[model samples]
Target: MNYRNLFYALALAITANLGVMAQGHKGPAWLSNAVFYQIYPSSYMDTDGNGIGDLPGITSKLDYIKSIGVNTIWLNPVFESGWFDGGYDIIDFYKIDPRFGTNTDMVNLINEAHKRGIKVCLDLVAGHTSDKCQWFKECASGDRNSRYADYFIWSDSISRKDMEQIRQRNSEPNPQASTRGKWVELDAPRGKYYQKNYYVCQPALNYGYANPNPANPWEQSVNAPGPQAVRRELRNIMAFWFDKGVDGFRVDMAASLVKGDPDKKAVMALWQEMRAWINKNYPECVLVSEWSDPKKSIPAGFNIDFEIHLADKIYNTLFFASDDPWGAKGKECYFDKRGLGSLDYFYKKYADIYTSTHDKGYVAFPTANHDFQRLRTGRRYDLQQLKVAMTFFLTMPGVPFIYYGDEIGMKYLPGLQPKEGSRKRSGTRTPMQWSAGETAGFSTCKPENLYFPVDTENGKISVAAEDNDPRSLLNFVRGLIKLRHSSPALNNDGKWQLVSDHSKPYPMVYTRFVDGETYATALNPSGHSVTASLAHLGKAEKMSLTGKVKYKTGNANDKIELGPVSAAVFKIR
Candidate 1:
């Protein structure tokens, strides 16, 4: 081959070897072993004594977060907001909310985190904004043809036919924003009814519909002047933060953009445009979307799409038996001590996404986020059960997000009165428990002034208490992370295999292998001992074990045993 052609071939080979996107976008190679910690800033740390957590508080905990083995911290929206739907109803993209901290504090936090080899990902509320946003206020008060007028969706009145037509054409399985379909009304001077993305306080920004029905004058095409401008605004917002040294974004309601199109083709195209722009400008910045479907989101150009654990999502099979409070019962989750759960649900979805997107992007998993219950909630709080769950998450493929305070087994405090619209989720978003005290070391302020009351059991599950105990859950998690960082076979793109087992949910066995290196893992969530066959290892000698393994065998008949609610990782020599 000619020199130029040979060079092109070599480049393609190198990209493939590095497990990069086939589309030529250089995804953040750091995400290969990235262990992310999701922080709901308002509840993470309170330094101001005003009971609200701030960017400075986050900066103060950089060492603690780093020591826990998190290389990336995902902070929920820090932008100025109306505070109706948590911090998601963003009013200003460029300025940090006064409740959080100043813009300088954010930059300082980013710099401090990077000094500890940690990347910071801020939540991007891409779809909508606070009704109190200046743009929305102007749009509401101005003429229909005003500059900010087309920034959001506005209509005089919606007939039944129009609502049905719009909903029928917009195709995303279970669309969140459109399901409500409740538009707010205003006086005669302003538009009669305005469209909303979520709560009443938030209005959906106009990205325009992918396919506009000619009969519906309200429906705007994606190429319309307003949409194109909104797209530019989105780009500008990203540029503002990227300039400030922010790492990337976990885009909220990513798939909810670009309405009125079946098959989500137009929304996908919109993100593709974004991907091209970001690739050209900030190639190293990662974009992890809350699309929850990696098969489409990865191909659509996001670096990683979270495989969220929701009722309908694939992750509920494991770690969440029910969504209710402590000891609630329903379908037994894969992490339950009863071992009544099935892996078929999680495995099928996981395998399909992994098979299609492994080389292109990744499917990220979260222990828990601000929206739902935690790993220590319900009847699953036992340290052994948690260790097994952590082992499965840390060693498994894709990025793993440890929601703030999940490392030390923070409880999902139930029945705390709702605030900032957390509702039943208020318990899950409680302050991080650091140590025993009146405020549980979360803040020096009075207990009544806390963002949400610290858990009553904080004395038992606090981080400081666990950090000093060698056998505690905190130490177990640290060990798992250290091993994950040290093992190539357990890295993001390692070839994975499921060891055969007849025990069903008793013992979950899988192996990670690459470049002649291999590591086998077994998780027994059951209440009794279970054995898994390691015959597939092919004369490979057992090297070392990470977690507690009750029994292991080495003869030609290879078998490893697991204790109740325990996990073991075996390094294959």
Candidate 2:
């Protein structure tokens, strides 16, 4: 064989597999163009008339999901669970809950999703287990010598006051500080107390604490026998699923492990161990984190992580967050239609992360996740206003997740009765409205039997209705998603830079550039119109949500006038 021919073949193979193979640790190659749709399993659909979304139900919608340009599906916790804390409190790591389907159903779902070029990411609760879990039950005995007695953290001596003292150590910038956090007691007085990650029923798994104090005997070292065993089991759990053809996992509360590690060196080390194992065994699999800290999580072994956690006020400033979360209503969010909001704060936070880590990994921004209010909630109710927001979500840098039903302008109905443990979050997770049928195309069961109530007020907001209207939010989202997938500069690895003055953010502008091609996106989500001189950015066919984007040649360049709550994208230098 000629040397030139062999070299050409090698380069071609590497180019084809660049994202996953050539670029090690960046993420799976498929993720470069992946757009995620997060499905709250019980609320997506009910195929068996059991009033709960199942694996088969998701399998049935693969076509619809693909049509909307979603290439990845992040299914929230489908494993066996006690249903407490909305499936975060896992019962069995190996078995799929009968409520969702069998383990084989999951394998089939993965096979079917892979057929459509859709990757499936299951939610992995790596931190803890429900009190009902056999591991928890066995360890709850407080028997120090039992096989699984060390699987979870246990203490019969430390008091609540001491727990508070432990909480005070290295706890300044923490996000998961809820009422049930820190520590909880055994329900039936089992002579032992255990640490709690979220709810009382969920006991924290012992991955070891970072700083093992001599005073706190319950604190185990990161390399102790118990912690070492837990680490092996985590790998065992992941390998079990990976062997069944699962793509990857969205690790829940990823940063909440290795307690007492203020700097989180130990927690990162634990995941790094997991990542190394995955790199060797399942190189194509990816790991996204709920850590909300891209700076740390990306380097710590996650391929992708959240741009902002709900507790972080930075993201809150862009959406429906108030300056004082407990005291007031939402202030001037950039997406709100009042013309009072600005993107300066959010842009600064986002740009810092992008500049530092864009090449190493990605940061994810979901339009509205399980913990967030929908885009159509409260003062942001107008559909045109939402269109502007959707345009930004689709065009922005990094991987984006569209919550199910948000494409059809789903409403966040507040004050609904809670289910399982979804208190206020219940409103954000109502069933998907497939049509205007009697049950909103969710389930054949009676309305009362649903996981929660489907919005009766959203009678005209079903997918069937929106699919018929080109101007509907659903159709607009579909078009935007198609544009994102088709555009070379808009994929995950593209460079993002603020295209407008940060101080004057009314007409928020940004550019995504890759492979020497550039595109500019401008948005005016305020109640009033604004004009900006975008001379440097030449022009191309405009992809817009409103007709208000008027252009005029001013001297040397084009000046764009964006109308109220309008958005447009143009190809430029």
lDDT of each: 0.79, 0.80
lDDT of 1: 0.79
TM per candidate: 0.90, 0.91
Q: Report clash pairs, candidate 1.
A: none
- Over 210-276, each residue of candidate 2 has an lDDT whose tens digit, in order, gives 8789788878877778887898899999999999988889999899889899887778767776776
Q: Model 1: per-residue lDDT, tens digit, 433-528? A: 888987788788998888888763748888877888988888888888898888778877787877755336567888899999988878887887
Candidate 1 TM-score versus the reference: 0.90
* TM-score of candidate 2 to 2 decimals: 0.91
Superposed by TM-score, candidate 2 places the C-alpha of residue 288 at a distance from the truth, in angstroms, of: 0.7
Candidate 1 RMSD to the correct structure: 6.3
Best candidate according to TM-score: 2
Which stretches of candidate 1 lie above 4 Å from their native place? 1-26, 161-179, 188-190, 310-312, 323-330, 456-458, 538-557
